[model samples]
Target: MYRYDEFDQQFVSARVEQFSDQVRRRLSGELSEDQFKPLRLMNGVYLQLHAYMLRIAVPYGTLNTRQLRKLAHLARTYDRGYGHFTTRQNLQFNWPSLEQIPDMLRELAEVQMHCIQTSGNCIRNVTADHFAGAAADEIVDPRPYAEILRQWSSLHPEFSFLPRKFKIAVSGAAHDRAAVRIHDIGLQVVKNDEGQIGFTVFVGGGLGRTPFIAWTLRDYLPEADLLTYCEAILRVYNLYGRRDNKYKARIKILMHEAGLDTVRAQVEEEFERIRGGVLTLPEGDVARIRAYFAPPAFESLPAVSLVETQTAARDPGFAAWVATNTHAHKVPGYVSVTISLKPVGGIPGDASAEQMEAVADLADAHAFGEVRVSHQQNLILPHVKRDDLPAVYRGLVAAGLATANAGLVTDIICCPGLDYCSLANARSIPVSQRISERLGDPARQAEIGPLLIKMSGCINACGHHHVGHIGILGVDRKGEEFYQITLGGSADEVSAIGDITGRGFSSAEVVDAIDTIVNTYIAHRASPDETFLAAYRRLGMQPFKEALYGNA
Candidate 1:
């Protein structure tokens, strides 16, 4: 994690003081609600349907043990006893009092975390792969670049008030775990033939009322010109993106109207003008940012461990958990452990204050004190020793984080729909909870195999439903809760947005509809080995649609 320097410290402290004064003015009647609206939003505060919601940024989804502990403290002392980890790798507190937010911000600042740019029509948190540095397939860690973008875009004068919110994601692994295609800007770090690292930049990719898969703007953007090229894309969008209608203000609409070629051409023209200006990322500056993300030391050990194999044989529960929750690490004798937030009927990403604290302690004790928040709404101890698996699992089980449902059906990614978001038309969390309860059996989920089921409350696509293998989007019809299902969507190297199966289903019918789709795939798949995505790709959505709608 990057430690805050004096400038960074001063900037955050000043912002906190400013926001505190603004809140005081609002309370004292010196500033009306209308006047306080923008000020509150700029500080990541939202007046939700029920209460004030504050989103706190977790930069590039990386945090140290101390930071995790601070989040736990916030949850315990300030708002409710839990925090909702969002799809963008940030956390949201649903019930923060308006007056206490500044104190909360100060607490966050102590740990080098803040809510700046977490919301409100500006560049939001930049997400990267959870396994950025530790993934076996990574060419380079994407966090340094993400941090650079964070610094450059924070309180940027020209882009402080865009037409709508902007999101950017980065991924270094061949697998697109970051869902880069569904963001305003997606940067995939790739190595050229000569082994020099660069980015493959994608633009106009977003999910909302209008979902668009981003188009590759450049095949290879040099490391030095990342900010310059990014500035060009934003300049193009800022100048021409629709602003008359809030729904169409996103760059996706601009891409739809201007055509990708025309937009790319304009961006290219702008890039040439600013390639060597203030936006140019200098070599030493890059080095300075990279220094903050240095890799942890690992001890060499033999590949196959008899103790681990024996432990697996002794306890089927631990074995299953190890099989699902643990991932391959770049180093030998170390495994990446995913602490699942989705246990059985629990909320998808709600971690209690105690759970957060336990995760921090586990990270410190077993994994070099580094923690990562996954885009899938889980926490990762990226470098746990294989020998510490049982102890870690015990700790996680006690904390309700030891769900062996990673990549399984119950490991749902959901947005805080009507429950917390004012813009939501339907409730997303309850639907997710219902589906999860219906599919609560761990054995059943394991047998069902690998699946990515994502839910968004509305077309805003905060839950990233468009990219889930089975996507669920909540909608409202005549003031009733309804759900629209999309199938075969993937967010990987071969990413494709899922297609709507047919008519919407009522809230009660939605879970059964999902079950029908899964059962249909199970019955009609080519072999037992064929995954849901594979079978869907082979046969298309008609069979599943027919099964769900029943000969409509």
Candidate 2:
């Protein structure tokens, strides 16, 4: 994790003081709701359906035990005892009072975290692969670059207010776990033939009412020009992106209206103007940032843990958990463990304060005192020793954080729908919960193989439903909640928006529809080895649609 310097500390402290006064004015009636709207948004405060929502940035999804403990304290003391981890790899406190937000901000500042640029139509939190430095197949750690972007873009005068909110994701691994293809700007770290590191830049990728996979802007952008290239793209978007309609203000919409060639030409022109300028990243700076993210001290041990093997032989529960929750690590004797927040029949990403504290304690004790928030709404101990798997699993089980459902049907990605978001058309959490419960069986999930089910309450696509293997979108149809299902959506390296399976289903019929779809996949797949996504891609929507509508 990148520790904040003097400048960062001072900047955050000053912002807290500034927002404190703004909040005070609003509470004192000196500032009306209309006047405070932008101010509140700039500080990551949203007036939700029931209460104020505060989104705190977890840069590139990285956190240390101290920071995690602070979040748990905030959730316990300020909010209703739980916090919602979002698809952006951020955390939201749903019940924080407006008056108490400044205090919360102050606490976060102490831990080098803040809410700035979290809500506004600016460059939001820069995301990266959750397993960045520890991934077995990473070309490089993308978090250093993400941290650099954060430092550069925070309160940037040029991009302070864009046509719409922009999101950027970086992936160092070939697997594309960061979902780079679905971001406003996606950077995939690549090595050239000469073994020099650079990025494969993609632009115009986003999901909403209109979804798009980002077009490749540059097949290879030099590592030194990362900032300059990104700035050039932003400049192009800012100058030409639509400002008339909020619906079409995103860069993705601009890419749609203006052809990719034209946009690329414009970006190239801008890059020519700004290349090798002040924004050009220096080797020293890159090295400095990289040092902050150096790999932890790892001991030499066998690749396979005999203790873990023996324990799993005895305990089928642990065996299942190891299969689903643990990921391969770059280091031989270590693995990344995903502590699932999505228990069957529970909310997808909501973690109680106690759970947060428990995770913090476990990270401190077993892992490297570090935790990562996955975009899939799960917490990861990114460098856990294979030898300590049993003890960690036991601790997680005790804390009720031991749900072995990572990348499974029950491990859903969902937004705070009609329950919390005023923009939502129908409830999302309930639908997600119902689906999870329906497919809660471990054996069933194992049989289904790796599947991602993402749900959004509305077209805002906050839940990233557009990229799920089974994407569920909730809509209000004649005062009744209905869901539109999309199949074959994926957020991996070969990213594609899901295809809608004909008509929307009533809330009552949606879960059954999902079950029908799953059963159809099971029956149609060549073998159990074929994943739901692979089967859907091979078979297409006709079979699932026929199964759902039944030859209507």
- Give the least accurate 10-residue stretch of model 1, judged by summed lDDT: 299-308
| lDDT (tens digit, per residue) of candidate 2 on 1-552 | 799999999999999999999999999999999999999999999999999999999999999999999999999999999999999999999999999999999999999999999998999999999999999999999999999999888999999999999999999988999999999999999999999999999999999999999999999999999999999999999999999999899999888889899999999999999887899888999999999998888999899999999999999999999999999999998999999999999999999999999999999998889999999999999999999999999999999999999989899999999999999999999989999999999889988988999999999999999999999999998899999999999988999999999899999999999999999999999998999998888998899989999899
Candidate 2: where are CA atoms >4 Å away? none
Tens digit of lDDT per residue, candidate 1, span 1-552? 788999999999899999999999998999999999999999999999999999999989999999999999999999889999988899999999999999999998888889988888899999999988898888899999999999989999989999999999999887888888887899999988998889999888888788889888899999999999999899899899888999999998898888889999999999998878887888999999999999887878766667778888998989999999998888888889999998877788999999999999999999999999999999999998888888898899888788899999999999989988888989998888888888878777876899999999988888989988999999999999999999988887788899999999999899899999989989999887899999999999888877877787
**Model 2 TM-score relative to the real fold:** 0.99
TM-score of each: 0.98, 0.99
Best by lDDT: 2
Candidate closest to the true structure, highest TM-score: 2
